[model samples]
Target: MSRQMEKTPAFLTVVLYVLGFSLLMEWIKPLSQLTETGNFNVFIVFIGMAFFLYAVKAPRWIGIILKGVFILFSIHSLYFGESFFQLTWVIKLCEHVWQNTGLLFSDKLDSLSNEFRSLLFFVLLWLITYLLRYWMLVKRNMLLFFIMTVIYVCILDTFTRYDGSKAIVHSMAIGLILLGILFFQKIKEEGPFLSFPAHWVKWLIPFSIFVSAVLVFGYEMPKSKAILPDPGPFINSILASDRLNGPRGLEGLDMGLRENDTRLGGPFIGDNQVVFEAKVDSDQYWKVETKDTYTGKGWTSEDSKGNSFYTTGEMIWKLEEQGKDTSYGGQKSAFLIYQHPMPYLAYPYGIQSISSGLPNNFVLNDQTEKITPYESDTTHPTIVQYGINYVVPEYQKKELESTTAEGSKNEEDPKYLELPKSLPARVKKLAAQITKGDKNWYDKAVDIESYLQSGQFTYDKKNVAIPGKNQDYVDQFLFITKRGYCDNFSTSMVVLLRAAGVPARWVKGYAPGNYTNSTSDGTRTYQITNNDAHSWPEVWFPKDGWIPFEPTKGFFGQTIVHENVQGSLAEKEQKPLAPIQPKKPLKPQKDLLDNGSNAKIKAPSQSNMQKISSFVKNHKTSMIISVIFFAIVCLFLFLYRKKWMPFILIWLYRKKSGTETFAKAYLLLLKQLDQYGIKRKENQTLREYAVYVDSYFETGTMMMLTKQYEKYLYKGAEDLGDWKEYSELWENLIRKTAG
Candidate 1:
């Protein structure tokens, strides 16, 4: 008898049903897009019916038949039915899976149709439901069921991005179901039959309270740092070799582009896979590497050399020489890499030192401030984690302008100023025209930057035009195609500055992503993703080092703002350039003869909606908190209306009625009647109201109370029935109406 009871515990069956239902609800989201007219309610109903049938002790054969039927129904509804039962539907699905199986390992998994994806999800759901039911009914392992259920809930919470309050409610429901299962297990362990376990109630109440309190107050728990240990050398070797082929098999890793690639033409679409997390005090461009050599086609660093450094548990690569003096404040930043391993490390402009448990074979290029590992060191690499001490330089425009432009010239090689001989003369002419009147190199660079960022140019990621063979890239972009992405804009600025005799290099890295959270140790964490891949021009100042400039319209640049330079320096710079402006805007060159195909170009501006979206993104955390608080308040009012409404009505009535005790009592009675769905309308007289109540209760209590109140209110009669009697009638009426 005991063995039989284990096979079919009622409590276990109920828990299984509830768990399956919850999982089904979760799958509704992924499946909704696949169904016709976006109506997935039929599938939900079918799933609920299956659970209900199983809970009622359906025969094994019947359950098996029903499961097969449901699978067929799902397949038909998602694919074949849409095709009117064509024989080719199954073949099409098979072909799709065969062709796109490779995409599963890349970020292109979303390329599959929603219907096919939903069919796959349906199979997964069916299997999970079967396993869960078998575990409870056949294996009779309650502990295993509990553990698996908890794991499933955790995965759902992590991946689904459900809001806080909804997650809490779901968690609380699961907890209650688990508690019920535990109680049933306890009863089965004892005897055949037993009395209610009244003694356990005392402990259960406090446990429930403790759990509730934790759920409410601990919603924003500190997120655990994503620190998975390296999967050893063999696996890292496979990953390293695989990444060279493409980002096909490495979806989440930073596998899209290499740091020093020689070509940069493609669609600017990004998967936005998060690559790493940084803990810092303020926001700054996290620079990974810089390119000094521009080969007319693309940027490269083929001839660059670096100082090799070996790690002895903690490696430190100083940004400057030991005796060098600087006027910049320093801060510490730590980076935690998540996706694929890369040779370069992201740090701020002026890094002082790096400390990490890194491999002993890495090189630091002081010129570019880039760190890269040896070819052999990255075999089977895991996530790279490190910290850096970096300086945030403060600049004074007067000092930078006064400094000589040739202060620290690398006379041996001036690769930054190198340009292809085939570069169009119009490029240099335009640069000269823009900065003709500038007195200093700083002013010239700024003027060029302002020209690019002005409304005359636009940023386009999708429709970027490529230059024809033997055609200069910057010339085509500047003189012909005025619309392009970050590379086009940044490269243009670099070439223009170099033409103007200012040292500028192309720098590429990620833009700072959403500010996620902060740690108790005062370290703020940010999430950086693949979509944040960006490029900007960095100009060298005499004593200020490399200063980044933003020439792209939609993107914000972190250039140091000079407060004092605007007053005197601006007047001096503007006076000379004022006359250079054309009275009538020159018509843009329509036929550049680069590609021999004319394409209409329009400069895009940041729309008002985009500006508002940017503002919301910057303040997303505060907005989410405010919305959650408002939802909680609304839920509280809705759930406990009975407990609070009476007090609210009384307070409101008292404010209106100063000292009319009888009138106040009548008003409170009307409010109670409204609560019971017996409201008196505006046109109903006191006698009519009493008659309506008498029809339901078959009592004159309402009539008696109404008559006395009307007599006292309308006739100014002080000698009405005792106030105590009227109060008693009001209480009796309320009690009767409630029943």
Candidate 2:
């Protein structure tokens, strides 16, 4: 606290300030949660580093202490990395890279073998090593330089709204450069780099930086952007919630889908969405009807709009008690979060009752059990609830067992028997040919599914040459050309059956998602993808209500039996998966969000995130090795500082002292040089060195010494200056040789 202590240089004060600021900035905005603002905070890291560099540079005495701090912080930063999840999320990123990379990038994604996480640790190690060596000798003195840079960058990135603090930490390199400029003057022969003119040599680092930035940013952005599809469509949909469905709370998101037609107009891409996740209780083939009759590419519903049976308080439970539940079934209450308005909520087949989550204005036709979204204005995140009776076979079997065969409901409806005007004769003949003896409706539907899928048809997304592109897609799908995907197959079958007087309606929804092992919970989870999109049909049975009969062979037929498929399809068709994988299984952690509605049970929670991360930090051997390697490098430099002076000379010549080489030589040259005022051109040869030496000295004495220098030392190594003693001798030789 004395005057002497206070006068211990501004650098030390700066370094302390830098440390305080780094801690303060870290404290003010702890890099914990990675929300949008937090992610932008990463940009401020540069400014924090700058402050740290300034503080370290502010004091030249605590080189060892500062180095230790840097190492400690770097290690700590790595452990606290996920806290900065805006930057890196190793596990999540890895899984995504593993799953979708092949889909986004071409051979680049496929060719790279998936390496384990340990390889990532090696990468981190290499990065730290490179950063250390790179900044080791950078000249960074003018604090103004960094301050100006930080201000400019903050202003520029403000448009990104990433947060200005990011600019602060990133610009810390200015501090490092200033420190190197002020203190770390020693350098060495970088390469044949000495052969280049000094101006060109000085530009090397900046030039390399420019080249690297161009290749990485300019070229990379365009290429990577081209590889990925625009997320604009999906993003816009999320933003358009206000116009799509009026004020449905988030919970009603799931139940409003079937009511989508009545939705308020907005930019909505419906077909591409994964609307419903249908998983049946029994493994029996789950079917949905999407087409009652086929026009061209789409199907029309043959069922008429019956009386509105959906009174707000009328429970479906009361009716199912009187009527029959269709399939072998059991159920739990359906809890749907309807993000936006849609039309129908498909309960797993044999839904005994509808208790909650249906729309307020929805008019559910009594006979069809259909709910329709009738309004036009919109909002989002509608949360709805549904409590359906399980209607297990234990109770429903009596109804199904005693029921008579399903007579054709289509007989009463003219719309069901109406075929598209453009129906082909051959298709009609083929349909009649196939129906030769199959009077039973189930047998008839099965016959059609088999005939279409039995190598006679193929799945193709490409446009097919169907006659009458606007009408009767069935005739084209049947006899003329059978190569079609699910839409075509189901369309053809549904229309054909309806034309033959069997009641059917077009059903639009995703096929059952493939089951996967749950991570948090040990229950079965389904991985639904947009690829499972399809349109199928449901036919009305006499007392049974409805049954799903997918007429498409490529999709529905192949997915009918588990034994008939492999991998994901097998799991989807055959049975719910037995849980296998556990996320972070090593860390005993349980999610508190298990709301019991899912039927999944989560593992128990144990260590906090920080505690679990100790695995990397506690690697004693690696830490020891890093410390030893760093210390060993320092030791080698200490031992060889003298021998390496020549390399150091080359390195230092580019700094402020490089321009004023006389600073070091001035003191040592005393015993050697009689004259004081003298200088040398950076490009001067030995002869030129001697001549420039005569410029500021008494001409004759210095001139004579310079003349001899061309004769004695013109060849190669003589121009090099190593020890301060050698520099003094060179200066004296110039003076005395000239004198």
Candidate 3:
């Protein structure tokens, strides 16, 4: 007789389907590391609800209402700073939708506000959930989703820093189980059998056992080292040359700092190649140029193409004359040794004169503050070395704070305060909030600088986000992705200062390079590498001229302020200031970076263990969630064992035809009956218990099965005629228990 198998319960099937969908959702969680895709938990909550409603057969209108509520709550929580019931977020959302509708009609999709983008994302999630519901319930298949999940994880594992090894394992387990259940369900519905066949379980058991064994072996077995070389370096080498050229081609091939300011915001790798060696009295910021214009994306100067002048003998490159009231205490000289030919000279603040070894005349670009050596008026020269004489000013704090916009040249020029029309309003609002109570421009600038380095922002090099085409760089850095390098910090400070009516310009230069050695005269020679290339903001003060401010965390600039001095004797006794904490070393510890201080240029000497540890730390949240999800899946399987174990037991003893096989299968039957709530009392005899179970199930098959089981136990039977002949009675009782 062909024994029938009971169908898997609808509730169990729904749970499995929901679990499969949940596993696929895990793939999206890693995106938080790369972009401002806030709180992946929101997705999980919504997805779970959607699946639950579908499983319960909830009305379509209820699903629509739930979705609307979720969207509103998401907007209120993520976009607004007030209560959920507040209408401000609703008004803003409506405005964004209307504005974005027009932009969409004009084919300017990238220009949509974040609120509209978030709404679109919510809609996308809704669409995906609907499709998943349709596929798992109506179509009774999830093979396509399974395949897509595997591909998605594999791509992320290969291209991004996301470690998808665990995710791949999860996908395999969930996908196989889901496919197995759906495949069986399809067979139960369409196969020629009038009832569920026990023989199908016979086939299924071996298939499942084989797959589980493969999965266990694959996960637990030792993995062989990859035979292929990593392609990262080869690919990076190809792209490095083009990126080093800067946004504009006019910027010369300087290895350290590029002259490009048109496009900013993205991760960059560090280069340790030494660009120049500077022997200085003390470490100071090596200023290359200052940009005055903010075009929403990057820095530019309105006067970049204005005028040029040629200087021959001792070159004077001062921006403005120092007044008698300004105190210039220390006059220092530094010699620079160039490793390669550079288009411009990098000098310290308060520079008085410059002399180069090259025979080329120096062309001074006033707009860019670039001093380039030329063989003739229009020809280039190879600049090997240069000498600069500068005075490090010790400014009086009282004068600086007291200085107003009365004599400020910056107020007359709008270029220093220029902002793009497309710049987001929130940026200015944030700047105003930061400097609300500050009375003077210097105090406001200081507050803004302090706010950036106040631990709210993170300095990262590898996973920084690049602004989209229509996105404002400063706005993104300030509001969305609050993680970046010196460029992000510096540009934001400049924009904030400008928005607050304090004139500020973006300055790009190298950090006082790493201290290498000291000379006989006590002059320290620092090695400036491509990694030392950095940027900062310079606020224009009437009395102090352009004062540099360090906004980047883990870094401090050499800006010294002195108390007001009345006598000449006290001025003479003002000793030379030592370097303000030497720039951190290029070499890293066992850990690659600590709070990302040396991220400007990191040493490439990370050990294998360090790399593994860093990977674990970066993806710790994902790892924890993966482990919890695995535990939950295991618990679910254990809790529902009765619905699944009968097939395993039947498949196990189907090939055997003896008394021993009969005895073992009969014992399994008793256990299934107890689990199904028809328990066998300790006082009842085997025949009586069987009758009790038969009465509970409203069938006499259990009583007949018990007689065979008792015969197997009492009689010394060498063989049971054919176990298949009596299998129908056992299967009939087991199928009833499954129900």
Candidate 4:
């Protein structure tokens, strides 16, 4: 075979790289919501493609240096901006990195900010483009490229739940087209392999026919329920037994908030895994857990009253004073557990009775009104599949407003009014300030709730920063940030209310999920997912018990039944709080002489170039210094190129330990030779290249290097002693060949 190998045009390589990357981006678009920005991705792809092409032709050392500088600049622009020039920014960046290092494998990943997510996407795209360029241009490994492409496609398919089969088909088509291009390039570069002869075009027709048949057959395949495997007794047995202990609460009679056992943190986005389907009579907040004690950080609940259960044959549990009475407005509903398996049953505000396959040993926490099984029975576990008869309270707002805290003391625990000793005084001050005019506790509560709901604060999910170690969450949220999710708003409102002598406790549960299809029996099913996890404040009234209040904007809490109370309250001569506006300066008095004088006024309008020139003129000295600094830097780089180039290359591309290290060193040597007009042919093996080089230059070093490389690559040798030595040998070869 001829020593010279046919070379693909640089432009053609760039085209293929861009095309492949675009296809891959299309496939991965479904992986994250952040990737939906087509313009951003296109911009990044363009920049990346340009860099890759530039790096391919430029000196390896220069390329590495440029890439480093570019990366630093891009990161600074994206994350720090002008702050990057300040020493404080570096310190803060380090602190942030140190604090969040553990989050890579932690649940806190769910609460990552969109900015951080975007940064992560940027890094991911950078790595992908770098690898593509390396594999296509440097390694020329088509097989590796194919494997990576397939893995990427599989990842997209696995992680993403596409709306329709069309997305899958589209991704598949892209994959096929990309693969075709890859194969075509491979055949052109390395020639046809054994299975496919030089006349591979002859097999194309049959292959196309087979692929079409397979696609048709797959699409036409029956998709009936019968096609699914039956979840027989074995599956049920496994599910019941400890052997198949899936996620806690999935199998049934599990109780207690397993996830919310401690303090709540920053807002988190949740998975769309449907926990249950409930058919309720009214749209209400599904109460799962209630916290009585707020430790400033989070909430904790007191112990249950007692393990009280009826020995009656029927699977029924009843609460005290919560009996079958029309006065309580009793209503029945059923819940079908779709995924989650929790111990506590979800019900409306007042759950009177529960009946289903649930264990009769269900105990009720009177303080929190949360129900939990008395004991765990492995044999007959209580799955979430149960029916509940709950009582919905109907309270007249007028009566609630008039009701004093005299009799409510018996119902309202002192803990509800408890605030952290370190709680900022400004919080209480702000609360008192807001409710200064309100006479009754109900009015005060309404004022506080209204103030929170007013356009004073913003609800932010991803941007909600976690409270510092010693900082109070509510204080920071109210006075400083004024931006947060439900927990922030609700907790702040609760604290403020408590500060204002209004008894309120934090409540945790799920929001009324989206209403799905209705059953044949006229019951509407609501699909409750993990994302429905919510928290609000419950204020205590004399007879109304604990009434839920939604301070979080956009959420509806306990339906405020207004019976002449809302209108009466609105009509009460309560002046609306004037928004704090900036104080304007007093206008200057007009002078009679000025008015009499003919003074012409002209509006100043500057072009873009004029603005630029003005800016430069204002900073002329700084500009001159900057120009001098730039010239100095350019001169320094040119003079010290020999000294710094190799160091930069080694820092950028050196591998610590592996056969790959030697391989990379060899590739660098080849690139150096290419620059010196002694290019290694595409098809030339290491031994052949060594022989050719030794013959051409009368050097024995290439032969020795070739033998070591062969041992490392083919013979599975691990002790490829000190890669620096290989680098030194390559440097020596380049120096000798330069003559």
Which candidate should be chosen as best, given lDDT against the real structure? 3
> Tens digit of lDDT per residue, candidate 4, span 104-223?
568677455434454565566667666666555545554555555556555544332223354545445545544554555556566645234545565456656666676677677876
List clash counts for every candidate, in order: 5, 88, 1, 11
Give lDDT for model 4: 0.60
TM-score of 4: 0.51
For candidate 2, write residues 230-264 as lDDT tens digits: 33333433433433444332222312123222111
lDDT tens digits by residue: candidate 3, 1-739? 0011124466755776577566657666666653445556776777777777766767789989987898888767766776777787678778888889999899977477767877887788778887876665556688998999999888766644567888888888888877776776666656457244586678678978977997899799999997865543333322333343334433433234767677776554345666789988899899888888788778777664654655644536443344323566676788787654466788898776665533347766666777777666446554547777777776777777775555445633567777889989999899999999887888898899999998889998656776765789999988998999999999999999988988888898889989989978688999998779999998877655778899999999788877655764335554433422222221223332344544432333545544554566578689889999999999998998888787777777676775566667788888888888887764579899877887787889878877777676667455455577777788777877767
- List the global CA lDDT of all models: 0.62, 0.43, 0.72, 0.60
The CA root-mean-square deviation of candidate 4, after full C-alpha superposition on the true structure, stands at 25.0
Q: List the residue pairs that clash in candidate 3.
A: 5-196
Better model by lDDT, 1 or 4?
Answer: 1
1 versus 4: better TM-score goes to: 4
Q: Which order, best to worst by TM-score?
A: 4, 3, 1, 2
Can you tell me which runs of candidate 4 are displaced by over 4 Å?
1-130, 139-258, 261-274, 292-327, 330-341, 357-360, 363-369, 376-382, 402-436, 448-489, 499-501, 514-533, 552-555, 559-739
lDDT of 1 by residue, 242-323 (tens): 4543544333332333454455543453434566777676666878778888888788775456466644223344433321
Q: How well does candidate 3 match the true structure in TM-score terms? A: 0.48
Which stretch of 10 consecutive residues in model 4 shows the poorest summed lDDT?
579-588
Cα RMSDs of all predictions?
A: 25.3, 24.0, 16.2, 25.0
TM-scores, all models, native as reference: 0.42, 0.38, 0.48, 0.51
TM-score of 1: 0.42
Alpha carbon lDDT at 65, candidate 2: 60
